[model samples]
Structure formats: C-alpha cells, structure tokens
Target chain A: MTAASATVLITHPTGLHARPAVKLTKLAKTFEAAIRLRPDGQEGWIDAKSIVKVMGLKLRSGSRLELAAEGVDAPDAVAQLRALVERNFDENV
Target chain B: MTADTVGIVIVSHSPKVAEGAADMVRAMVGDGVRVACCGGNPAGGLGTDAARILAAIEEVWSPQGVAVLVDLGGAEMNAEMAIEMLDEGRGAQVRVCNAPIVEGAVVAATEASAGSSLDAVCAAAEELCQ
Candidate 1:
C-alpha cells in the first residue's frame, strides 16, 4: 500500500488551535487511512486524528505542514485534508 | 451517527462555565457525540446542583454510558449525587471522572465521538491529568 502525501500552508490566523485542530481531527476520522502531520521543517509527524496531538503542534499562520495518509483511502484522505487546509478550515480569517 | 459511543456531561459551579466547556467539546467532536451541561444552583447561584446534573445526564444518556466532567470540589459531589439519582440500571452506566472540566470534556468527547467504549473514554479524560 502506497502512502499519499501533501504539503499545505496553514492559513487560519490562529493556526491549528482548538477549533481548527478539532476540524482536522474530525475530518481525519472519516477516512480509513492513517493520517500523520508535521510542520513543514519539523522532524516528527504526529497522529493527525488525535485532537490533542494536532493542537500540540501549535502551528501558526503561514507555517507549512506536511500531511501523509496510508491505507485504502490514502489518496482521498490526503486530497480532502489538503482542501480543508486550503479552505482555512472554513473559518473566517 | 450514534455508534455505541459514550456520552459526556459538564458540571460546573457557573452556568456559563459548563456551557462554554460543552461548546468546546462540541467543536472538537462535532454533532456526532452527545454532550450536556449542568451548572449553577437551582436558585441560579454559583454553586452545583444535583438536580441539574441529573437532568444533564438524562439529557445525554445512552446505553453505551455517560462520563461526567466536573469543576471544583462541590461539583464532583453533586455529580455523584446526580448519578445516584438515576435508576439502578442507568446509574450503573454513568461515571464521574476526575479530570479538568474543559480539557477532560474535550478529550472525553473526542474519544467518545470515535465510538470508544465507556472505559476508554474515561481513561482518555483521566489521562489528561498525567
């Protein structure tokens, strides 16, 4: 099984705080794939499906993130997550 | 969307605190998990009420189970009393967790929304203190 990955810039003014982190984790739960994320230049990837872990990233606006998903729906998971990031988690900036 | 997941209740001395904590949990878990808030005295004072806690528990009751996150000392006692007020069968499915109200509620709600068992949800909430 191949892993699908994408690099996205955090656009939400507050970054991956509580609200956006919740959105990210909730969306990640919808797919069967295992999702992992890390700051663009960071070394470690954390479980994207865990709200606490996602919030711990403390990503700020303009911080780039690398997301990877592995499983049957890896491609779909990666695409949807990328779209969510691009949409700023649908929150007003 | 109900997947044998545990439910959550927030008990606080102030109504706003409970509601705000519930809001945070809702934001994290979305609409899938059940969450309820119980706060303030019956007279609308800054104190916990057993009746209100009981109502909140009933509001989010589920066969899977319910976890109550409380703030302060009195809140826990009221929460326990509220659980005891339930019928034996229903009461058996409820637990008052020892965790920070806001953080525990969020963690518990997140775990519950993922269809976690009652024990798992409680464990997740309790783990936040570590």
Candidate 2:
C-alpha cells in the first residue's frame, strides 16, 4: 500500500484552538486511514484522530503542517484535511 | 452520535468546579461525547451528593457505558454509591475511574468522542495518573 502525504500551511487566525482542534480530530476519525500530523521541524508525528494529542502539538497560525496517511482511504484523507486547513476550516478569518 | 461514545460524569465537591470541568470537556471534545456533572451538597456547600451523582449518570446515560471522575475520596465514595444505586444492568456498565476530575474527564471524553470502548476510555483517564 502507498502512503499519501501533503504539506500545507495553517491560516486559521487563532491557530488550531478548541473548535479547530476538535474539528480536525473528529474529521480524522471519520476516515478509515491512519492519519498523522507534525509541524515543519517536529521529529514526532501525532495522531490526528486524538484530540488530546492534536492539541498537545500547539500548532499556530502560519505554521507549516506536514500530514501523511496510510490505509484504504489514505489519498482522500490527505486531500480533505489539506483542504480543510487551506480553507481555514471555514472560519471567517 | 452519542450511542457509539462512552458517557462521562464529573463529580466534585464544588458545583463550579464540576461545571467548569464539564465545560472544558465540551469545548475540547465537542458534542460527540455526552457528559454530565454533579457537585455541591443539597445545602449548597462543598460536598458530594450520591443522589446528584446518580442523576448525573442518568443524564448522560449511554448504552456504551459511563465513566465517572471524582476529586477526592469522599467524592469517589459517593460516586460509587451512585453507580451502585443504578438499577438493572446500567450499574454494571458504569465505572468510577481512579483519576483526577478535570484532567481525567477531559481525556476520557476525548477518547470517548473517537468511539473508543468503555475500557479504553477508562484506561485513557488512568494513563493520566501515570
């Protein structure tokens, strides 16, 4: 199986705060793929489906997001999550 | 939505603390997980009430099971009583986790939001103690 990956920039004005973090984790859970995320310089990847781990990352606005997923829906998971961040999660900012 | 998630109850000596913890859980976990809180005595003082805890469990009752968080020994005792008081099979599925109220509830609810099992959610709360 091939792993899908993408690098995107977070443009959320407040970064991945409560709502955005919750949204990200909840969306990750909807997919069958195992998705992981890390910041540009971070050496460890965190489970995107876990709210605690995702919030622990403390990602900020303008941060470079590195995402990768491997599983049945790897490609779709990476694409959708990338779009979500790029669109600022539909937040009016 | 809540059917697949484990339920959570926050038990504390202070009503404000219980409500505050529940607020944090909701803010972080969203509506995917069901959570209820009970604190303060009937006299409006610092104490845990078994009746209130029982009601809180009922409020967030889930077939998937319920995880209860408490602040101190007294709160734990009362929470256990409340869980035992649950009639029928509901009591069997309810658990009083040995973890801090605020942090445990938050982590447990977070795992529950992901459709984790009752044991998994309880384990997540216990992991915080380590």
Candidate 3:
C-alpha cells in the first residue's frame, strides 16, 4: 500500500493529557505506519510514536490536532487513532 | 562520588503518564540527568514487559544509583519488581524511594542536574507529602 493517511481533529475537552499521549504513542508504534503529530500552528512535526514528543506538546483539552499515519497499515492505523481519541484517551468525554 | 547527574525512573499504569512526568522533568532539568519510565498493564504491552522495564532502569542507572519516583501504588510495585529482577550487583545500586513523581520529577531533574544528591531529591519529595 502507498503511504495512506488521514488527519483527525482532537475534540476532547482536555485536548490530550499525558497518560493519553502515552497511550496514543504506544498504540501508534504498534503499526508499521509512521505517525507525526503537529500541534496547532507549530512549525515542526513531533514523532507521534515518541512519548516524550507527545507529552512535550502539552496539549490542553479541545485543541485541534492532525494525526498523520503512513505505510501499509495506514488504514487500520487511522481507524485505531480515531477510536483512541474518540474514547477521550479512555478518560471521561 | 560527588554526583554530576542522577538517574530517575517514573512508574505509572500508563506509559504516557510516566513519559508525561518525564517531560515535565526535562523541562525543569533539561538534558542533564537521565530519565526512564515504565507502565504496568493488566495484560502488559509489547516492550513494556518486566525485562524491558528492568533494562530501562539499568540503562539509566549506568552512571549513578537511580532514584525512583512512583505515580501510583502499582508504579511502586513495578519499581520494586524492576529492582528485584536486577543482577545482584546492579540491584544494589538501585534505590526505589516512595517519592512523589509529579513533584519529585520536577525537583530531582532540576536539583539533581544542579549536582544535588539522591537524598536531596528524596527530601524534595518528602516536602510534597505535607
């Protein structure tokens, strides 16, 4: 598969918390796809697979984020990514 | 030895939580001291196995004895398990203190990087208990 991907807007009120970022990074690394997180208005892309990078963003709840995944597993990756975020990182919605 | 840097381990149920704690530490201390973290799973994650966490702890503690900070009760269990799994020699160098990870990470990263001792880090954590 060509590097397929999708970007989802983060709608959780808390944007993303540390525990959630760690969960996202941990899940993201499970697939062959490369994940990059671009915080709103940020010039650089952080490795969504890196816990440090995810937490470094310090995203507050309700921030809009773009999650890009590329590689053979990009489809499943995108689906799972949406599930994780939609689950509000397993925190209360 | 007069310490130049300290090794820190953060434990939480979620790896992200632990990493988030470390991120805060990095902001306070920069790249001076080494930091590692592990999460406990009901089933467990791929690299989050016991061996992996123990190795992460040993890797960071290569320079000096490590000071462990735990976020939750389970974190304390994982830290102890990591220490127990260490080689007798390596295990001797580990110090798993019941310090406040949220507070201790900030203080340890800042003070330890500034040449503070593990005792000082523990003291900083103790202050949070009050």
Candidate 4:
C-alpha cells in the first residue's frame, strides 16, 4: 500500500537453494501480495511467487539482491524475507 | 524381511516426462515394486490439489508406506502436502522421501525399495545429490 512496502533484498553467499527457496515461496504465498526479486544489475524482476523462478536466479552468497513485495502484506513479506536471508535459508545447517 | 511394498509418485510439468523417467528406471527394476506417476493430462496429474495427490499416495501405499519422488519445485510442494496428508491419514505407517528424479535417484529408489529401510531409501536419494 505504501512505497515503503515495495520490497526488501538480501544476499547470502550460498544463494537461495532448494530448501530455502522452498521455505521462502511457501511463506510468500501466505501474504496477499505480489513478490519479486532482482539480483544486482539484472534486468526484469524474478517472480518470488514461483519457486522455480526464484531458484532460476541461481543466487549465491555475497550476491547483492533487491527484493520487492507489493501489496497489503508487503511490509510483512519484506520482514520475513530479511529473516530468511539472515538465516542463510538454514541450508542443512 | 516381511516383504515391504514401497510406492513411488513422480510429478513433473508433463505427465509423459514423469512416466518416461519412471519407465527408464523400471527398465532396470521391472515390476518388482509399485511405482506410480502423477501429472500430465492423461495420467490425471494429481490435479494441483495437494489433497488429491495425497489421496493417490495413500491409495498406492494403502496398508503400507510410500516414498514419494517429485520433479521440479511446485511438484515438490505438492509432494510435501501429500506426505503430510498421508502421515495424518496413515500415521507412521506412511512415509515420504524427497529425492531428485535423476539417474542416481531412480537407481537408489529402486534398490532401496528392494530391501533397504525407509531411512536407507532416503539416504540413497540424498546420495544422488552428492
């Protein structure tokens, strides 16, 4: 609803692999918003709604990212996303 | 060994693709185990409805347990939901394994079903990723 709720981006050295991407997609689906991700200098946003699209980014750790969620749940979406990246998707750790 | 009957469900963007992958693996194992493919129009593709796929998994395993193998990401979600449903419906008697549909996965699933424990089946699947 607000520009402040557009989206948030985080990059992990591991990038978003199978497990983390799965978690993120599931969480994103809970909110009434459209989510997208842009991996540093890449044109066009990737659909965060689709796990395949998110995985297609092949993001690795240290890759700066741009995450944007537009909708009533944008803020929450961004918050959760930040948490997920901060945890490095908890990949088998 | 009490003759454990393990079931497999393969989901992919295309039904034929899933079937083809299964067929390739079956070529090596034959009909020794119960293998089912979900997805694709003709195969009735588990209907994007998690419950539907879960029902199919339950039906396939019935009194026993099943090890589910799904292709791609969305199908994995569908598989996860199916496993949860089956677990709730059948309890510990029904189980699910998340494994790739690649050559190694196919080989491991078939071998594990032959005599290995569910944990082993899962381990075999994990080995493929390595």
Candidate fnat values, all: 0.33, 0.42, 0.00, 0.00
Order of all candidates by TM-score, from best down to worst? 1, 2, 3, 4
Give candidate 2's TM-score.
0.88
DockQ of candidate 1 is: 0.41
Task: Considering the true interface contacts (CA pairs under 8 Å between chains A and B), give the fraction that model 3 also has.
Answer: 0.00
- Pairwise DockQ winner, candidates 1 and 3: 1
| Per-candidate alpha-carbon RMSD to the true structure | 2.2, 2.2, 14.2, 14.6
The C-alpha stretches of model 4 lying farther than 4 A from their native spots are A1-93, B1-3, B41-47, B62-64, B87-98
Query: On residues A1-93, what C-alpha lDDT tens digit does candidate 4 reach at each position?
Result: 632233334455556765466566656656677878878787889777554466567777677667787887788888887777777765544
**What docking grade applies to model 4?**
incorrect
CA lDDT, every prediction? 0.87, 0.87, 0.68, 0.61
Model 2 segments more than 4 A misplaced:
none
The alpha-carbon deviation from the true structure for residue A69 of candidate 3, after best TM-score superposition, in angstroms, is: 55
Candidate 4 chain B worst ten-residue window by lDDT = B40-49
Which stretches of candidate 3 lie above 4 Å from their native place?
A1-93, B1-4, B42-49
Which tens-of-lDDT digit does each residue in A25-88 have in candidate 1? 8789889999999999888989887776887788999899999999999999999999999999
Over B62-87, each residue of candidate 2 has an lDDT whose tens digit, in order, gives 88899999998899999988988999
lDDT per residue for candidate 1 within B39-111, as digits (tens), equals: 8898878999999889888888889999999999999988888888999768889998878999889988987
Clashes of each: 0, 0, 5, 10
